[model samples]
Target: MKNKSVGIREVAQHAGVSTASISRALNSPESVSPALRLKVDAAIAALGYIPDAAARALSSRRTRTIGAIIPTVDNAMFARGIEALQRYLSLQGYLLLLATSGYDPEVEFRQAQNMVSRGVDGLILRGDTHTEGLRRLLATQRMPFVNVGVYHPDKPYASIGADNEDAAWRATRYLIGLGHTRIAMVAAMSAHNDRASARVAGVRRALKEQGLPLPDDWYYEVHYRLDDARQAARALMARPERPTAVVCGNDVLAYGVLLEVERHGLQVPGDISVMGFDDLEWSRHLRPSLTTMHLPTDEVWTRAGEHLVKQLSGQPCVMHHEVDATLVVRESTAPPRADA
Candidate 1:
């Protein structure tokens, strides 16, 4: 005769623990003591028990699913964070549901509503510039959610990310230290992004500190696409008084800027110096290795996932988790040439 499916009760009995303990061990491992969890795991292995997801959902009202809505999944910067989030969530027996807004707040709100309707237990969002409708929906539902990519303690929502303003300030200051007064920035559009807005603020502040004026055309914002970056760089260079140094919003933008500058017969660090943000893998391998800011993408998203899980387990979570982004000096940046 075929053996009946092993159940939680059977596993608990074999493990000499209560059904409640078994449940905690399975869903909220952090809540259970190490010794107790080990015993439950051993019993589960010995009994060959497979948890009944449906029953757990019914009793706990948990979907064991997390949803994330980022600006754009097509970009590798956001893709790396999403990958890290998925790995951490899966380790906790939770599935990740992903959606992208193409940088549109309305689309992000619709996606958030759809995920909520689908009964996600938690959410991980890129930034907090979501539509008011989505904000109201989340507040009304009282669902656990964490914002990733920018950190602000004064905000109502919980967040786990790098301090965008400080990081950008440091990056800009590095360029100033290189003795480049004619500086320009190619940045991501700040229309609905707190991170981009904060970074722009940082750049402006850094320039002000050095008594350098940031003229209207000196700072350009565009989408997170290589082609847009190329155009922005070309336009900046076409100006009557071109900048000797350029700061890009991200590595991809930096890639585009570098290519455009080279296409114009300008030798990097000889006529112009460029700086990039986000020390991505390719940044290190570029012909003239990039001098950039190293944002901890994996660490931030992994921590965001753990924070969401803790909140879902009815545990108190830290509201603001900030990671550091440090400057990486490489070959692409140097003091402007004497003649230039």
Candidate 2:
């Protein structure tokens, strides 16, 4: 037979306290006497008492739940972060509701509204490209939300993100250090993405620092797909005076670049060098492991969860968090041979 769940009343009885005291001890430990709180906790453990989330929410007029909206669940990078967030929130008597917008702004807004209507105490959004209506709604509702994975200077909201600009700059500078002057960038479309734009800007900054201009023909922006990236790589490398090194916007793109490089009868780091951003799990296992920028995913998610928890509890949070990225040198990046 299935074991019946124990209720707060049973815990209260076991602790020799009123149900109200049990509730206060569980919800707001600071408001209860230490001795009584200990008794309540002991009883709860003994009985395996679990609070009814819905009932508690109704009584408190606040849902101890957070909603997170992201581009997609297909990406391992996001998968790691979101999983960590949910696990941490679960440990603190909170729940996480997740939504995927598939990188569509309109869909993102609708999902955000759905989460708000569902009575999430706080929200976690992916970026700052939200529609004006969505932004206004959040403003009018006075929703405590944090933007993750990107940041904005003029925006009056908290954000946690990696330093994409500096990371891309380092990637570009690494190629430059390899004696590759003719460099090319295969990047994602930055139309609605500040992170993508920042990456492109970082590459530009690196070139400018070397008194060089990013030639128009050397840059290509495509959708975030390996096939598209491969086609773009093929086209870029087919030029009569092809770039000696290609820096991709992400590790996925870099993987495509490496595949197409071999298809074009070129050798990596010898015929052409390749570098990527976001050192994914498989990046290190490549034939010539990808030399890429490593995002501080674990730390960023930890800080973001902490910020969201504070916001839900009406506590002040460090509004802006700028985590750094590191360069992981691998076999894919090397000096240009004199013959080339």
Candidate 3:
């Protein structure tokens, strides 16, 4: 196909200037005089010489695109965070390319590599689960990225997250204050999840402070599924020495617990109290108005966006960005009955 079209040379001729001057006027306007820069710009528009974006990026070394890799879009928590990030990026003359890794650490690393190769100006990640090998690769490539959900205490990377330990401790203490002596936990696998594990630690800390030790079988390690939560809740409740209250890893798990308790003809805060983390939107709307630790989703997202944009603009990111989670007391939690 013989396509006859205008090029930079034609535009330069139309502007009555050398190609080098036109290139400077288009690529680096600050280096060119105003009178000539305007002339080259008019010529460019008149000739319909659409500049290749990739070529422009290569010459100017900027794509104006940022990448955000999250665990999964299925959860409302991550969805809200990603939305805030995208909105903030758009206002700053940057675009966001989102990817989901389905909570797989290896997949997160691969997605990060792919985003880097695609020439993103910066990247945002959900947690610190990215393998050390991937970290090395990013460092070697000089790619700029920030951790959004969790923090690494010893490192200098930018991060924005709530105090998982404190949130968990508060939730547990609330349960204890309500006279829940035997408390059980239904948690997602925390081996590779620093956030989940920290939450669990907070629960233990509260228990230890209260001179209580969790039963061996009280800790249910399973995937974060409602069905699994239901089955696990049933098993826990069926035990001879069941907990008077249950603290779920998240709202989804708490919902499952409520469902299982209802099926067993048990009333929440009557027979048992149930608490959950991450005050999901539906938490307040639920029948019992769930009691949960309200993770500052909006704050977390806004701060992460601010940090990433600042870094991309060659500004120093805030050293310690920690937000507190608010505890919402609702109808779902109460003191355990003496009878169990």
TM-score for all models, in order of appearance = 0.89, 0.90, 0.84
RMSD (CA, Å), candidate 1 to true, equals 2.7
lDDT of 1 by residue, 131-230 (tens): 8898898999998899999887899889888888889999999989988899999998889888888888898899999899888898899888899999
Tens-digit per-residue lDDT, 1-340, candidate 2: 1124677778888989999998887665546688987798789788877777678878987778889998888777888889888888875657899999888889989998999999998888887888998899899999888888875555679888876888899889988987888889999778777788899999999999998667788898987789989998988877878888888998899999999999988899898999998899999999999999998776777677889777666677789988878899999999988988
Q: Which 10 consecutive positions of candidate 1 have the poorest summed lDDT?
A: 1-10
Q: Whose TM-score is higher: candidate 1's or candidate 3's?
A: 1
Cα displacement (angstroms), candidate 2, residue 313, comes to 1.9
Ranking by TM-score: 2, 1, 3
- Against the true structure, candidate 1 reaches a TM-score of 0.89
**Index of the highest-TM-score prediction:** 2
Per-model C-alpha lDDT, please? 0.88, 0.85, 0.83
Error of 2 at 62 (Å): 1.5
Tell me the spans in candidate 3 whose CA falls farther than 4 Å from its real position: 1-52
Candidate 2 off by > 4 Å: 1-5, 15-21, 24-50
